[model samples]
Target: MGQLSRPIPLLLLFGVLVLAGCGALGPGFFADRSPRERVLLLDTPFYAQEDYQCGPAALAMLLAWNDEALSLPALSDQVYSPSLEGSLQPAMVAAARRHGYLVYPLDQPAALFAELAAGHPVLVLQNLGFSRLPRWHYAVVIGHDLARNRIFLHSGRQQAMEISARLFERTWARGGHWGVVVLPPDRLPATAGETPFLAAAAGLEQAGQWSAALLAYQAALERWPGSFGARVGLGNARYALADYELAQRAFRQALLLQPANGAVLNNLALALAAAGQRQEALVVIRQALELDGIWRQELLRTRQKIIADQP
Candidate 1:
């Protein structure tokens, strides 16, 4: 945990928000849902690099769990935090580069928690994120346990440390349904150019600089409108800023290029809900849930929550 300098403002804000009694991340107060209920899981190490099929594969698993399967999101700009240890612990900036994922470069663990607040997952190269693994391993985030506050985590250890979502919440604030990292063989390029735009987006996003990321993505889109990467990242950036209308527009644009993509739909629905279109959001998310399949636990939760909130 270096200088939480980047997330100072967000750390301050998140602390106040949580302390002010804004409910923790989870199902609604109205719902009778209990932590006893199951959540989805994605098995990726906290800080993996080029060989990190687990993280990307876990993302694919989440979509599959939702009954909505598609190629992995461009993943070019999405960010992650990692736990590192020993001589194997290369810097996050360098590691993220090697993996072609954006690294926020904040050493402070508090900053890591802030990124969690924003909906991206963290990756550990060495053995960070977890205080101690029963058997040494990495984990991917799939869901959270608000009541317990742990990350509902899992990994590839001999027995695996499947535990409460709150357990991982020590440095991770927002999380849900984590465990069971279903994976395929090696996928994704081991490394690529850290696009200037990607770097700018990660820096802006990490510092709670949503407006800037949104603007940068918008600018990037101007140069490459059909860029799935730019559009998807723009949608997320807008959602973080609470500009749901624009966020939905961006996600919808991405979907146009890759129709029936559940991840895009899931996020698009979120943006719609934030913009005060709950009913429509529910409709869209339900469609994604259907695509993910009736057995998708994560989408099921999201669908049930939206339906429960329906007027």
Candidate 2:
């Protein structure tokens, strides 16, 4: 038979390709899809899956992608960042109860990255991985281009960039050390008034409407400056807006009133990290973790980032 006419070997090759990642198919001919879809790609799009994904529009898929042993730290910039204190696992557990998937977090970002390297899927908070990128960062990895050595993720900026998988692995491994809050699938606030503001803040942040959330928190503060809730809201909103100085001030003010408050401290550290004071951020984050026993697990992650940032 002519080599050109051979079909047996080619058929076997196709079968192997089909078996990749449990039948996972690369974009192949669809590699050049629009950036919008690319950024929002998920295991099941808007359905359920055991893959990472953005919110609401990607909830079901996120749930299916949920990793029970997996967790994520609060986005210091995410409005819900405040609610992440005191028991990250339970915190995430509660959140997942309502959102369909728990935002898992590790004690340290580095550990999480190592887990990812070993083939574990996790929800990583910004500052944890890709530290030098920007403040207020958030994203999820729905897929990866292993052969091409690329990592696929849905970024908070709503743009999908095909970053080098090797770059991500190296960067994530080296960096996921700042700090992390393990989130369980169920993290519900036990206090009143905490729910509303955090919900609003998360929504605003998800929509990239930081200005409005910041102002709303300010108005709440005017009526109740001592309200730790309001202050936390302000701090997170400011961080989301990239108002690093202002975020620091907000977190500081909240700390002054609620000294040893985990939310304010970790958030303050987050602000410091954004302001280019990573060491300070580590110190503050440690203080926050110590103040809340639930945060003990986060120490490693926070410490890792600090170490990586050092010259």
Candidate 3:
């Protein structure tokens, strides 16, 4: 009997498991019928994937388009998973940051299309086989023709493979519709909201890319003036770079927005201490300690540092 004709209990069980796993996603795909038709075929370079090297290939394509010259083999060294015979998601994000690009996962189909419309190619994951027998593949979406219901991708050996939107959605749904976009430090993603953008910048800071994180924080401030989080992030990045005067200015601005925040006061005090204003730093640190919060230990440390700096 053919595979389809056989009563495969395993396949049925896998289908149930997949559905249950995706239950929290609520639903798949957009409900609107008339999505805006757009054709923004960005001049993004393409690289044919070799065996289980689609991750590196797709990442190379994105980095090349962002004006970084990197070979697939070099990227493979950074992201390739030897045991799994493929690349992991965290490795992909790390590789992008390593090449000085800001990478963020897209959560919505509309956001993916929005990035394409804004001349950014999106990398996505797809499962080409059944739920039980998965064939995971990575592809780059460069453009789409919504009127014809067709999407274009740089997949496998095809530089411009055209597939129906419905088919694309089905395959993408099997992989949880995972999508990501890479942006330069000064640039922002098309679907970038204030909160998520700030989070991405903070992630850069945590990754120890102080210069890139500083640029991202400055960009955030430009887009959202008086943003408390952006101000705090800017202060943190500047402090890391030893720009104490700028850090103090940014922390002071953040304090204005969120007065009584011990964390902000603590950071500001540290910046003041670093700038040689030991008396003022001691006063600020004392104020922070008086506030009942989780930053008491940090405030105490800053007080000790300020006292130590005094002659």
| Candidate with the greatest TM-score versus the true structure | 3
Residue 238 Cα positional deviation in candidate 3, in Å, after optimal superposition: 1.5
- How good is model 2 by TM-score? 0.36
Model 1 backbone overlap count? 42
Model 3 gets an lDDT of 0.75
* Residue 35 displacement (Å), model 3: 4.7
Q: Mark the regions of model 2 whose C-alpha exceeds 4 Å error after superposition.
A: 1-198
lDDT of each: 0.44, 0.44, 0.75
Question: Cα deviation of 67 in candidate 3 (Å)?
Answer: 0.3
Q: List RMSD in Å for every model shown.
A: 20.5, 24.2, 12.7
Better of 1 and 2 by TM-score: 1
Runs off by more than 4 Å, candidate 3 = 1-36, 305-311
Model 2: per-residue Cα lDDT over 1-311, one tens digit each: 11111001111211221100001123331233212222223432222212222322222224444443323333212223334221232222344434332122343323433434433344433333444652322345544543464656555434345776444544444433222222221232112133343443343333445565565566556655576666766777777667789878877887777787554565677677767787787877677676866445444455565556656
For model 2, give the RMSD to the true fold: 24.2
Candidate 3 lDDT by residue in tens digits, 1-311: 11111111111211221101111221233335233476656588989988899889988999999889787788999998878888877788778887767877785678887888788899898888878898888899998776566788999889989987777887788877788888997798888887767766765765678799889889988999978888888888888888889988988998898778787887777777777777887788778777746767666766765676576
Model 3 clash tally, residue pairs:
0
Q: For residue 185, give model 3's deviation from the true position in Å.
A: 1.7
